[model samples]
Target: MNYYSHNIGDYAQATTHLSLVEDAIYSRLLRRYYAEEEPIADNMTQICRWVGARTEEEKEATAQILTEYFQLHEGYWRNKRADAEIAAYHVKAETAKANGKRGGRPRKEAPFSEASYGGTAGNAGSSENPPETGSQANQEPGNKNQELKETSPSPPTRASGFDASTIDLPDWLDRDEWCSWIADRRARRKPVTQEAARRQLQQLAAYLAEGHQPGAVIANSIAGGYQGLYPPRVQARPGPSASRAQRLADWTDDLRDVLASDRHPREKFMGTIDATH
Candidate 1:
């Protein structure tokens, strides 16, 4: 797999205690694992060298991280989560390839009804001067309007239509939003099919299930022009609130100084007192 999904929260949680160097080594190890699509050999010296863990402390930290997150399988260290993600990636890729070979999803055909048929029939006989030739006889004047209405260009349909029930999407996400997103993707020249959308929906659903907000995720993807869904960017710290509190504290100190100064009350109130006196 050329790429695999990563959960920022999961990664942050797992590496919360790791130092910067240790975290770098751990990230490199994970990349190697996914790129090779297999486990790393259980060789401390080689692993340390490969990950640039030159110091003894760095090597020890790397070993600790691996021991906590990976398991030795057949003399190689393997991460279960990474393996599962890679497997899922392969399955989705194969499904998409197969879908492409069979031609992308068929365009959605408009539904037919007896009422429309009756209207066409009513218009057909009302025309006193019927078309003389066989071709003209087949082409009714109202039929042209009906065909144009039926075949009016719309958003491209997926081979398999999106079914919200198949994936656990949030209640706020409706078919219109889904179709609109797909249309935007198509407009950007992305090869979006129903199957690919379904897979992305599955990923988004998983993120939502993990307690992430649906709106934030959707908005982030749209703004970033991401082809796949991902967790929202970590929120910035509450700097505004802290700054407001600091300003209030400073104002209080200034007020106390004014009241305590030896200047006249009116002068102090007018902010003309010199505290240095």
Candidate 2:
């Protein structure tokens, strides 16, 4: 696996006490681990050299971080989280490879309907209707001057860009919009496989079930050019009651100003007297 998921918060919490050099070493070791898809050899001299821990302090920090986050078994040190993520990546890659062999996703077909054929239900096989000549026969009933319009064929549905055979998508997602989004990603060189699409749908569904508008969520993802949908970052704003309270406070200040103005002599005199005290 060339890449893996990294949670900033979790990393920050775990490496809070480490020095900058130690942190760098830890990050490099993690990259090496994922790149090799296996544990590091349980040789301290080789580990220190690999992580560039030349100094005593650096060496101590590296060993500490490794002991705290990794487990040693059979003369190799392994990170559980990294191992699990690499395993998942392998599974997804294999699934995508198999899907490629099966010739990609199948196109969705529109349901057949009489309206789609461009004729009214009673127009077919009606004995009462008499055959007319020229334009009259071609024209629809009441509008004699207007010729019958041909029903246009429906627009072709877009391809899903993923392997349909490997993924079972939910009906809530708009297939056309989803396909268009995937195509856009591919054009940007951010192609996603069927497994990734399935995961994205799951996340999107969660946001939708929380009362988010599907259109808004999808629009946000498209505008940001993100491969996955995430919850919107909603800033905290004053609510209705808070706004009303602020308005009332402003009104009270205005009233006080008016009362203090010379236009009201008696009130102004009282305000001056209070100020003097």
Candidate 3:
């Protein structure tokens, strides 16, 4: 495949072969990430805010900008490394195998057998781990992970960014406000008074920011009026004390112990603790 085919964003950015809407998005993304120091998605939302097309016409314009922005350029495609050593190693191995010649013996791996590792033989009856070797002793969690964890990555709670469904942004506003509200909503559990209302709009604007204008959107959102929705708190009233506080709390003791482990599947999983809390 050609370099352009490697990335849809690249192809879209390469030429004006797409619709007006597509061109607009492609233009924004390029400027945001390459020209300006904004993220791709951020740029899209900002464009959404600026276009502010509430009707179908506006949304279409916004979509066009998105398509174009997603189009990565050839330089980025070239910059992206693909672990050439890995491919080279595989090619060499394949060539060696095809030649029907003895290429080389496999390197010996570190022995992990319990018999060869432990200090004594009779203690094998016990169920415990053995002493760490120098190689293992030097290793940290990252070195021996079953899955590679991203280094310097944001926590799962927030990274790249997080989904702000908890805030429940309104549909009336543009993209800049939407993203802003979500980000701030997670940071603060509740909004109070006019500051709340102010935050709501600014947040909406921030949410409207495009992928390329993420930082810009975030700034607008911080400055705008936005109010987060929170459920009203209901105060619990005291009921007639049928029994004393201590007596009522002690009801669990009075309830007869019943073993119904045989009646349900959960009981099978519970095993010994099935009868207790």
Better of 1 and 2 by TM-score: 1
Which stretches in model 2 have alpha-carbon errors above 4 Å? 106-277
Q: Which digits, one per residue and each the tens of the lDDT, describe model 2 over residues 1-277?
A: 7677788987898789977887898898999899899899999999998888898988898888789878999999987667656645654675668778987776555645555334458765444556677887666454532322333355668556464333544445566767666777778777776557656665565566455555577676677555566444453444555565555565565454445332342221112124565
Measured against the true structure, the TM-scores of the candidates, in listed sequence, are 0.42, 0.41, 0.18
Candidate 2 backbone collisions, by pair: none
lDDT of 3: 0.40
lDDT score, residue 155, model 3? 36
Indicate whether candidate 2 or candidate 3 has the larger lDDT: 2
The number of clashing residue pairs in model 3 is 63
- When summed lDDT is taken over every stretch of 10 residues in candidate 2, the lowest stretch is 264-273
- Candidate 1 yields a Cα-based lDDT of 0.66
Off by over 4 Å in 1: 106-277
Candidate 1 clashes between residue pairs 3 or more apart in a chain or in different chains: 105-159
Model 3 per-residue lDDT at 252: 28
Assess each prediction's global lDDT (C-alpha) against the native. 0.66, 0.66, 0.40
**Most TM-score-accurate candidate:** 1
Give candidate 3 regions above 4 Å deviation.
1-16, 41-45, 50-55, 64-277
